[model samples]
Target: MASIVAQVGADRSEAAWLVSTRREFKYDLAGELRIQLYTTKCSCRRAITWRREADIPDWINQGVKVEMETTTIESSEVKTAIARLREKAPFVYGLTNYVAANLSANVLLALGAGPAIGSAPGWAAAFPAGAGAVWINGAALMSSVTPDELDEAAATAHKAGTPWVLDPVAIGAGASEYDAILASLARRLDAVIAVSGEVDYLCDPAGRATAVPGGDAKMPQVTGTGCSLGALSAAFCAVVDPFTAAAAAHVAFATAGERAGERATGTASFAIAFVDELSLL
Candidate 1:
């Protein structure tokens, strides 16, 4: 599935298949299924709609009130936000002490979007409560966040009604603990706006994600990591709703990966250049 998304994120029709497939699995038999697509002036340049009924297409065409709320942010506003982030410095707090997360956060700032990278449950609650958006990168397990901690963070983000982006980094990596934490968070948080990952260890009933073929991008396994996707998430959340935020973020990264792969460069340069390129997209 990750391979499919990585390959198809740039191709609208193919990407739609992944969205619809995931929606069917995620929603189960609970609702009617309908799929809609939108055009956005962003890195990916496309949008997707998934409904659980046969009339969804008609509803979308009719501008049904329920489905009309999803919006695509103007490129200018995105540029404005990116410009704001460029001025502020990003601070980091998480289990994974690796500089990549911090670097990614800064890149997000450089491109646009204020970032708060705290894993302490208290800070997590406070940040998302007031923040316009939030990104939870489970890349670093950091002594295994308790169920209570994950719940508190998810709850705080949910209550604030802010966009929540979940990055289950390296779930397929050696850390079973990280995967466990992600599972708990997934079960506890019913309203995850969007999620991105390298492996398919976990996913929503909708199963919406844009993944890549492992080890093909030639980065140190740290290049173009969660930070890029998280930044893209921030981009959408800053302008659009969560679902759109998630979809756009996923597509942006996937498209970037496709672009990067086309060049066959090292991950470090690819990751850095990718952020700059994606922001403009």
Candidate 2:
């Protein structure tokens, strides 16, 4: 019997992310690299059994079983994005919230991008024009900064042909106004949205959808991961299209989260290890 340690989602019958199968694997989503683990060809299908100590132990009683399909963590578009980012070392301007400011910059720097968190009077208009990419987190308005600056940044990035990323998280104050602004900016880019979960769904402007799998549940327990994701996506946007940037960023993050979770004793270690894994990638 091949004892495979695989993590399954709450509902395994549905298409879930298969995490770790005693070996490295890869999956593809949004035309980007994905890591599909656990399902490999064998003469005896019944001999395969999966175990997840962290989430679930067995699904035998639930009448659910593992699925088939496997690939390698080999050459991928994500690597290509990383290469371009390191080569060009693009300048990414971030308008992040008070809480996420430092970590977001750290993440971008680890990914080999120059992170510029600017808030000067003309920073919004001037930064994006020269920045290879821009990142605007709606939660930044939670601080003293006004939403108007965010609008100016997004507008300038759009006009200057600089790829940018938006994470509309924790829009605490002036929710309606921020919503309207996010909607307006999203419309210009065709409003592609991503809902992160155990299985991340990446929807494109052209109405195409793809699912990316991997990531540890402990990721959410840490602060600033959402903002970090936006920063990473900004780095990706500097090298690739926004759609591919979003998908590749998600994949890279998931892979890092998974690796970090594997050896981390707690959340603190996991957070540190997460950044290390991203740098290694």
Best by lDDT: 2
Give the TM-scores of the predictions, in the order they appear.
0.47, 0.66
Candidate 1's displacement at residue 233, Å, is 2.3
lDDT of 2 by residue, 131-152 (tens): 8877776567666667678767
The 10 consecutive residues of candidate 2 with the worst lDDT sum are: 12-21
Candidate 1 TM-score, true structure as reference: 0.47
lDDT of each: 0.38, 0.58
After superposition, candidate 1 runs with Cα above 4 Å error: 1-99, 119-121, 143-148, 170-216, 261-264
- Per-candidate RMSD, Å: 13.7, 16.5
Write model 1 residue lDDT over 94-207, tens digit each, in one string: 222244466556555545555555466477557656665555443333434543554455456555555444433321212223233223323322222232334222232243
> Pick by TM-score: which candidate is best?
2
